[model samples]
Target: MQRQTLRLLSSTASIVFSVLATQASAQMFNSVQLHAAAPGQSGGMLGVAALSTPEYQGSAKNRKLIVPVVDYQWANGWFAGGSNGLGYNFSGDPKFHYGVRMTGDIGRKEKRAKLLRGLGDIDAKPEIGAFFTFNPGADTYFASSVRYGAGNDNKGMLFDLSAGFTESWNRNLSAGASLGASYANDNYMQSFFGISQVQSARSSHKIYTPKAGLKNTYVSAFVSYMINDRTSLSLIVTSDRLAGDAKSSPLSEKTRTSSIVAAAAYHF
Candidate 1:
C-alpha cells in the first residue's frame, strides 16, 4: 500500500510539471481574444480542496493547488479554443488528475447572433467540445475519462447525453443538479465502482470475484459561494449506479454511494 501511494504521487507530480511547462511556452494567436462577459478571461484558475467520502473519512487537509489555462481565437465568424486543467486531492485518499480539451464553432457571425438571441432569455448558452483524460492508476482505484458534449447547453447524446441548470441567489449562494449516462469500458467501470479480485489462501482458492456491478449512471448536485471576485468555495455530491455484467458482482449489493467535496478556487 505504501509503495502504491508513493507511485501515485510521483506520477501525479510528473504530469503537473509537464502541463506547467507547456502552458508557460504557449502563445496566443492573432484571432484570440478574452471573452468580455466571462470571468477568468486570462484563462487560469488555482484551487485548494478537501474532499470526503464514506469510504475514506477524515478532516479537510492540504491538497495540491492548480491553475487551468484556456486560449481562444476566431476568424471569419468561426472560433477555436483549447484549455488545460490540473488538480489534486491529498487528504484521506491522495489522487490527482488533469486533461486538455479543444473546441470549435461552425457557424457564421449572423448565425451566432441568432443563436445568442434565442438563448438570451435562458441563463445558459449552448456549447460543443471534446475532451481527453488520463489516469495513471487505471489498474487501481482511479479511472480516467474522455468525453464529448454537443447540442444546446452541452446536452443530447444517445448514450452519453447530460442536462442541468444552475442558479445563484446571490454572489455567495448557488446550487445546481445534473443527470447523465454513458457507455464505458469494462475496466473503467470496474475501477470506478471499486470492484476487485479477492484471494483466499486457506480455501486454496486462487481468486474470487466479488458479487457487485460497476456503476455507470451518474447524478450530481453542487452548491457554491463566492467570498470575493478571485476566491470562492464550493461543494459537490455525486452518485453512480452499476450496470450490465458488473452488476452481478457480489459487492454490487450496495450500488449507491456519495462524496462530499469542499474546494476553494482562485483566479490569476
Candidate 2:
C-alpha cells in the first residue's frame, strides 16, 4: 500500500511541473511591445510642409526694407517728430489688449512735381490730418484717419480704415492676415489706386490708387519660421481690389493684384 502511495505522489508532481513550464513559455511569447511616439513629441519630422523652406520670404520682396520713414513710431504713448507727423496713444497696455492711437501729417513744400507728372500727376501739396487706431491685441489692430492736402487741385480730405491680425502656432512658426479700406477726395483717391501717374512716378512715395474709384480694399497673408534663436525667414503675399469711379479712369487696371516676398531677419 505504501509503495502505491509514493507512485501516485510522483505522478502528481510531474503534472504540476509541466503546467508551470507551459505558462512560462506563453508569457515569453506575449511580451510587451514598444513603439515610437509621433514626430512633434520628439521635435522631429514635424509634418508642416509649408515651413520647410531653406530660406525666408515675405511682402518686402525679400529685400531688407525698413518700416517706411513716414510710419515710424515714437515713445510708447505717442509717435511724433518725423516729417510733420504726430501721434498719440490713448491705450498703452499690451497685456490687457486694448488701445488707441491718433496720428497726423502736415504739408511739405518740396512736392516732387517733375516725378509726380510722370505717373498721373495730381500735383497736390503735402496733406495734414489725424488717424485713430484701435489695437485689441498683438493679433488684431484697426485704424481710421482723415487728411487734408494744400494743393489747389489736390486739396481734399481722405478717410481710411484698416484692420489686421497675426497668429503663431509654435515657438518657431507663425502666420498673419490683414484687410483695409479707404475713401478720399478724387485726387487722394486716384493716388491710392495706382492710377494717379503722379504718385507712381515718385518712387519715393510708393503709392498707388485703384482704377475703379475712390474705394479700395486690400488683403494680405504671411508665414514665418525661425531657423534658430537669431535667424528667421518669412513669406508674404498681398492683393488689392478696386471699385467705384477709379475703375473707369484711364489708369484703372480693374484687376486683382498679388505680390510675394521672402525675407530673413536677424534679431539684435
Candidate 3:
C-alpha cells in the first residue's frame, strides 16, 4: 500500500469587493480529478505527500514522489500555487462554474534504455487552459477542460472530459467514482509517441509517426471521511491505459498504469 500523511494549516481572509460577494459555505468536491482537483476554498494549506507513478508514461519502472504540498486561494476567485498551477474563476451559474487554470507537464526523462539513446529529452513545460464544471444534482457532476502548451517544450493542446458520482455512506464518510478520457493533438502525439528517422538511426525501434487521437482513458475511485470540523482523510485509487497511437508506440510498455493515494487535509 502507498500512503502519505501530513498536517495542513488553513487560514481564511476577508476582502471587500464592489462587484462580487463571497458564499458563506464551502462544499468539498473531487480532489483527485484527472484534469484538476476539487473547487478550492478561500484558504491556505501545507502538507507532505507521496505519489507513485511510472518513470515515464509507459515504462515499467515506478518512481515514488515525496514532496511538500502547499496551496492558497482567495475569496475573489483568484488562486495560485500548488501542483495544479494557477487560475481564476470569473463567472458561473447555479449549475456550473467557469474558470481557467494551468498544470505542469513533466515531460519524458528516461535513462538506461539502449533503445532510446539520441532521442533526446522532452523538457518539462506548462499547460494553460480553461475549464467548466456542471453540477446536475447533489450527487453527480460533469467537467471538461482544454489546455495548450505554453512553453517551448511542446506546442500541442489537450482536451479532457470527465464525469463522476458520489455516494454518502454515512454522516462522515463518502465515496465517489469517476471516468475520464484525454485527447491530444498531432504535435503532442508526434512529440511523445512518434519516432523520427533520426531517432531510428540511433535506436533499436523503427521510425514511426503518429496521428492525433485519444491518448488515454482512465477511472478513479475515492473515499473521504471527515475526522472533525477541521480535519479529513481521503483514499484514492486510479487506473489508466493508453489508447490510439499512444498504445502502439514502440516506446510504450502497453500496461495499465495504476496508483493509490492517501491524503489527510485540514480546513479552517
- In TM-score terms, candidate 1 sits at 0.42
Which residue pairs of candidate 3 clash?
none
- Model 2 Cα lDDT, one tens digit per residue, 1-268: 2222222221111121112111111000000000011111211011111211101111111122222111123334443322213434444443221222222222222232223334433332555565455555434566565656622355555566666555666666666666666565755444433433454454444445433234556676767666664345556555555446544433433334444444444322
Estimate the lDDT of model 3: 0.56
Once fitted onto the true fold, the runs of candidate 1 whose alpha carbons sit more than 4 angstroms away are: 1-40, 54-159, 186-215, 251-253
Per model, how many backbone clashes are there? 14, 30, 0
Consecutive 10-residue window with the lowest summed lDDT within model 3: 16-25
Instruction: Give the alpha carbon lDDT tens digit for every residue of 84-175 in model 1.
Output: 22211111112332223232211111122221222112122233233322223322222233333322234321123344444555545666
Give the C-alpha miss distance for residue 69 in model 1, angstroms: 12
The CA-based lDDT of model 2 is what?
0.37
**Which stretch of 10 consecutive residues in model 2 shows the poorest summed lDDT?**
26-35
Estimate the TM-score for candidate 3.
0.78
TM-score of each: 0.42, 0.50, 0.78
Better of 1 and 3 by TM-score: 3
Flag the better candidate by lDDT, 1 or 3. 3
